[model samples]
Target chain A: MKSGDYLIVTLAAIMLIALYVNMWSAPQQAGDRVRIVAEGSEPIIAPLDRDHVYRIHGRLGDSVIEIHQGRIHFASSPCPGKQCIHAGWLERDGDFAACLPNGITVTVLGRNPRFDAINF
Target chain B: MMRICHGAVLALAVIGLAACGRNAGEHSYRLFVFGTLVDITTYDAQRERSDRAVQQIEAAMQQIDHDWHAWRPGPFTELNARLAAGETVTLDTVALGQIRRAAQLSATSHDLFNPAIGKLIAVWGFHNDDAPSGPPPTPPQIYALLSARPTMKDLVFGDGNTLRSTNPSLQLDFGGYTKALAIDTAIAILQRHKIHNAIVNIGGDMRTIGRHGLRHWRIGIRHPQQPGAIASIETADDECIFTSGTYERYFEYQGQTYHHLIDPRNGQPARGVLSVTVLHKDPAVAETAAKAILIAGVSQWQYLAREMGVKQVLVIDQNMQFHATAQMASRVKFEITPTPDLNISKTVP
Candidate 1:
């Protein structure tokens, strides 16, 4: 085959690979967001897709929140129990992590959640 | 105004669908009724059909709430009032069916699941709009009500739907089991509308019809001690899954916990069994059986399950020991199995 045809084949292969990768990994951005509610204040809504820290100025004190790769958690808090961090990752809808001491909470939400009903 | 309302809703629905794109095959509608979240999820390739089906099911739930609410000033309240007044009250067809079923269960269960203890329930402070808080009814307070000993037998089912209570203090309350019937009614409405893929979740107890798409419905039973699910179970097609737990409604009183699951026999919070999960084809049976088994405590749960005809049952007692029926053990996928103290038996001695 000609040199031009070889170059064309390699470019097409790379393009196909890129398209397949984008299609398969797209649901990660399925508009999955988290609602962070600070006690005595309106909720601070943010996207779960982005990796960032939200220092919520709560009534008691500030709470440092973290969102990493479509998952969220209390990276650190001033609360005594540290139960919020122990709650681990907040990745699915209705999953909640709260530092009751500092009066801060994070809840995951999306259109079609994993569980239809949640029992206590 | 009616035409305008219809047109506006149709426009919003169309706009909402277009915004979500054609690939969105699943639709979810969350409505709050019966003082709990009622979520309707349907998997239909046509989004519009899913939306309409959910609307009809939500309407049916609202109707059930209006008709059967126990304490609210509705049909149930009036019936209880009439019965308490010692006057013959004629029940409608719907009321008669529910009352009869409730009465039969109350009788056969040895009053362990009696709804006729409305007065007892109210005296315990459970009749409040929300979960009863601390300072539970004192011993004297409880003894006063216990003296009456209200039972379903107090109600005499005369010819047809006519009913009268011999005990004037007797009051009928179906709060214990009406959610189960509501769940069943919601499923029937969805099926009648030819929508097979749906889930009717009342409060936390739920039932599903058909597959989410090509897979069976999956439910996660929440652990009594934690914030997450302890085990997951794949539901049989059109199966009803329910859980009765102290965590559902309770308050701490000087380190002691007082829950809302009042034992009809003694008129107090059931002493043992943290929670019970029952899976069956009938929603009402699954819920009622779970309640009966939970109140039965660990020592008698196996026998209760047997008498209740519940083949699939999972129970976690106050000691955190996990127990499952052979049938339930085969289906449960424990996220975090309990400690070495696990009971995998048909019955416990």
Candidate 2:
């Protein structure tokens, strides 16, 4: 309980805090799943799988669409200019994916539904 | 007891601080240059070797730039200016040798990897730092400038530094292959300098000279759409990895995107693919593979990779999906978290 001992403890605490912050702030971990649903359609469902990474290929109408796992998002599409793809990834619930070209809206539903059938 | 506690704390603090200062044994350097190689190596001897190699490369770049740039060479600055004037310039032995090798590869790639795109690039206003502010050029304007532009075949070489152009409008630009060529040239330089192990990253075009001690060079392929996101990391022994993507240098107007990678099929920017990374034994091959894959677009990429017999490649499409050749998947040693969605389908074989 000496004053010098208090100083040492405080220094060690600060160092630990700094280390924790550095580790915590280091980039987002990769397992977060992002879902995309095509608007007006029967809810086009795509889920990003952790075991297998998905690649979004080609354009959806005017919007560039990416599907990974079971999730889908707009990568970049050539609608009028290509404003949607430039908007980047949407991983959170309630995030809306829009493709002006096809009038497709991909919304991320909070819950991911399990598939009853597997299609080749 | 109090003294013991203070001593323990001091010892622990010293250990922690020492750990912070500990060198990883491997080092990296990043250089941003319009032209010239930015060689990064682990050892001091290798660094010196890279320095010498870059010196020669800069000299070679200057030689080619002088032959093509609009500043001097006056009227000769035009594409095929030398041929039009009927002047045959004697190239140095190194230039002649490199050009011969590059020309042969250019021929093989069906001019898909043309070093002669200099004239076309200049016409597109990319050579200038301050590009002309206006709408993109019309098709007619593009055609007028590039219609009669020279092909790689126009370049003819003879004994000594002597080079001739069969066409009067053929301009020689080495920008496309120069960096990759520099990697090869620098490796050669390092070999001559007796330095064995190094890594040369000329603006993301990476080449590993030799292994650093027991460890191989591990390079990460950056995701095209996401900045600071690594698509995959691969280990290499002595090979090189070259990547060309639409994201590199691009400007958006209204809604259209204009990037640096111009499709030779059309004078406009290439679309569909976000990025293309090529793994090859030589930097030059990697460079060509990167360019060819981008030009071929997404659907044709697998076909092209198979035809070219390139074992390793990573292509990210506009949809933000990742596609890799079997070779690329095998080479990957690590993946960053939130690994981008990847599509792994067999190339027709």
State the DockQ of every prediction.
0.16, 0.03
lDDT of 2 by residue, B246-344 (tens): 865556657776777777666777888888888789777778878878878888887767666677888878887778877677665433566555666
C-alpha displacement of A2 in model 2, angstroms? 42
CA error at residue B309 for candidate 2, angstroms: 3.7
TM-score of each: 0.77, 0.62
Summarize candidate 2's per-residue lDDT along A1-120 as a digit string, tens digits: 777676777777776666656543533434434433333333334445442332333234444466555455566554543445654555544444444333444444444312110000
- CAPRI docking class of candidate 2: incorrect
The TM-score of candidate 1 is: 0.77
Model 1: residues with Cα > 4 Å off, grouped in runs: A1-26, A30-32, A35-46, A49-116, B1-24, B337-341, B347-349
* Alpha-carbon RMSD to native, per candidate: 9.3, 13.3
Stretches > 4 Å off in candidate 2: A1-120, B1-24, B27-39, B44-80, B84-86, B130-134, B159-161, B212-214, B333-341
Model 1, residue B291: distance off in Å is 0.8
Question: Which run of 10 residues does model 1 chain B get worst, by summed lDDT?
Answer: B15-24
Error of 2 at B296 (Å): 1.4
